[model samples]
Target: MLGADFYMPTRVFFGENALQRGKEMLLKAGHHAFIVTGKSSAKKCGALDEVTTLLQEGGIPFTVFDGVTENPPLLTCFEAGAKAAACGADFVIGIGGGSPLDAAKAIAAFAANQGMAPMDIYDDAKRLCPTLPLFAIPTTAGTGSEVNPYSVLTLEGGMKKKTFKAPDSWPRAAFVDPRYAYTLPHGATVSCALDAFAHALESYLSPKSTVFSQTAAVFAAREIWDVLSAMPGEFDVEMRTRLALAATVAGMAISVTGTGFPHPLGYSLTLLDGVPHGRACAAFAADYITYNEKSDEGRALIAAFAAAIGTKPNVMKAFLPGVAEVDFSFTEAEIAERIELVAGAGNYQNSPYVISKEEMYAIYRAHFLKK
Candidate 1:
């Protein structure tokens, strides 16, 4: 039997011209909008320009804080929040990829409680203040931070990547214009699509998964897999649109069920090895599939999930290997050290089975260490 509860708060607008709805979401959010984004993608993609034009034409005042970087640090979030507070920003608009969108959520939380210390943001009890309303415009197809309340932040030291989730942290609305992602490079397209697929896969396999979440995950996974498999030459605008929808659907599923082992296991690869978040997670997924297939119960669940996505279990597992290779190399001892890091993550409990340290280390060594 599946879990009982399902909840997703963000009002999503998907497709080619979704940016047109931004003016309406902005008006409903507040008067002054603090736009949080990366240094370049937003401008290069023309999302920032379109949003700025909408705000100006609508007579809405706004400020742009473009300091958000890849794998956004907690200190950067604190600084961005301070900027929002100092400027009296009533609502926040997050543009670009997952980093900016996740930063926007944290910035909203921190801006509401400007008195709280940077580290204090992690203390759930201290997050009592109402977060500023957020409107998201995602330029990339991965991360799906627009629709989810959880904000994955790498703290100041960059050693720990943690999630800060609050009910109020969900974006009030999301404008997912795939047109903004039309020019995304080939590497990013593959990595991001795989990330969305990973989100759906992990959420479906999570012990907390509900029927509703599984439905969303299956649909999203099918879209991602099909689109990824059918890429002919260069990625066109239509491909971007499909990937965006897959990401959004996957985001909604993860919001309800959260992710399982791969995400927690993949974090060290990203933080330590400098692997991109999507590819790092991808590197662990093949091992995750193999591990799950070891038990009859796991095999049954995998079969159902595979059926939902229109494939056999063995074939699905075979396709995962391509997405699971990374460029980093480590020795046996180094791999063991990294395994310890994953053991500390709280998300381990969400895995369908009890994952022992030995099992976790084996998975790490098998996927990460070259033979």
Candidate 2:
């Protein structure tokens, strides 16, 4: 067990119809609100309508700023902050996927105090002030941006994907309703589910992991691997519910322990190659774990836990999708170069073992290349 501090300040409302409490939660923050959401999916599913309606019924005046992009940009968050100020929003509401939720957090923090750019906030979180109250309603189950204090956004000038972590950024309230994710596109479902798995596994191996965080992360990994990997192409309701639950737990685990290695390296791919965060991270899990096994840390425990949950085979298959008929389309040199590039990312700062740059490069090539 490693020594670490655990801090979880967000109030969460879970399960079906959990979103109906949004009205009460918003009222606690204040009457005037600014809502942030992605432009397309939430509107199409009518999830945005439910949130807006709840605010109206509660006699809360709110304005929805639906400009969030796939990988939230620093410039967009800055603009959104200005909009919130114009609306006189006393509280900021985030009502969509992780992108929108994270955007709301940054925008809310800057709405009252223009001390920092969203990209710069990650580099210098002290610039954020304790201003406009924060609340989150997640339309998707992955990222756990609702409860966690970190927000990942794409920075301008060189396409850097940055991280923002501040105590004041954690939402005062977060509403999780599995019903909202049912309408997510198939690609998004698979990608975000994989992302949750990465969160669970990364946190499980973190040097800062405590007993509680390890248990939450491992169980979340097991549950998600069992549910999402086993679900048929049609995406059954029961399976989706189980996946959603697993995502929430994984999010909670990362909130305390934090993730390592694969996340930073994965962020590079998402930012540069245009791969989705979840998919890019998931692709590296097997290789990264193989590197951990060399240190003889938690290898047997991981394998046993995975098998006990009846998920080893399916998860293995799901993550290494390129092994099958799916074409990876990467040359041997390109793969190796990418591995070396990500090694310089300093992800080792959060890794359980200090991995040398060369060793990190080898790990990527080991799994990516043929046996």
Candidate 3:
């Protein structure tokens, strides 16, 4: 049995009306709220209205910063942070998908510290300053950003994605109402669900996996796999709820064990090809599984995970392309450059098996290089 050292502080509220039910707890995060979100999703899903109404009822003053973009640039976070500070936001509420949720965490850091440069947020030393209290209201079923401390931001100068996490970056509470995800289009639904799948898969295969994290990973992976396997033409409330719970559980798994190579390996695709974050990470899932299968312990782990999900590894591998957009082609030069860019990421070290650059290149070539 693997030793456990789990520490998830985020109080997760799941089900149909989680936001409404958790309103009293949510209001306790702070006196003034900085609500960070994208322009449309939150409003469309009625989450923004719900949150604002709650604030009004609580007599809490709030500011809305609706500029978080996909991949959430560092500059945008800083700008939002400045606005949050100016408004005297004592706590932060992140709405929408992963981008806004991640941006909210960075904004909280910046707002609390005030005057720190954009890049300074990534510095480990800067973690000495406490971030403002954060509450997450996810509008989608993927990314599970509400439960994790990690905030992936697009750094300056190259559009590269980098992640930073501090102890206080975890949201104080997460209102994971699945009703908000019902408005998601088919493509967005697929992308987000696949991202959750990747998170669970990678966390299960990570060398850092503890018994607790592995259990969570298995549960999450199975739930997501069952939902995706059904391939619902339109996700009803039930489907959305399952995915939302799975994504949140997967987030918890990664929060403990971190992730394996697929996450970092997928980043170049997101930056260079504009692939959605989840689809990008999942594009490499098959290759990641195959690489890990080379080791005895890895093979055993994969078998266990496969058993938990009630499917064979090859079956899962073959099913990925149907649910994930994985056929994007790249040139040989581009593939080589992409490999070199992510080769140094610490994520690779977390893999169950040591991955070599040659193996990484081979995987890239097989999936993406133009023939």
- Against the true structure, whose lDDT is highest? 3
**Residue-wise C-alpha lDDT for candidate 2, range 198-312, written one tens digit per residue:** 8887787777787777777877777777766554676677767877877878888888877777776676566666777787777767666666665656565456546745656
Instruction: Report how far off residue 182 is in candidate 1 (Å).
Output: 0.7
Best by TM-score: 3
Estimate candidate 3's alpha-carbon lDDT, on a 0 to 1 scale: 0.88
* Model 1 CA deviation exceeding 4 Å by range: none
Tens digits of lDDT, candidate 1, 4-27: 777778888887668685457677
Write down the worst ten-residue block by lDDT for model 3. 320-329
Model 2 steric clash pairs: none
List ranges where model 3 is wrong by over 4 Å: none
Estimated TM-score for each candidate: 0.96, 0.88, 0.97
Model 3 agreement with the true structure over 1-371: per-residue lDDT tens digits: 68789999998888878988888887777789999989899999999999999899999989999998888899898888888888888999999999999999999999988878888998868656799999998988889899999999988865577887998999999999888988899889989999999989989988889999999999999998988998888887778889999999999999988888888888888887778878888877878888889999898998999999999989877787556666767889988888887888889888778788888898898888887
Q: What is the lDDT of residue 5 in candidate 2?
A: 61
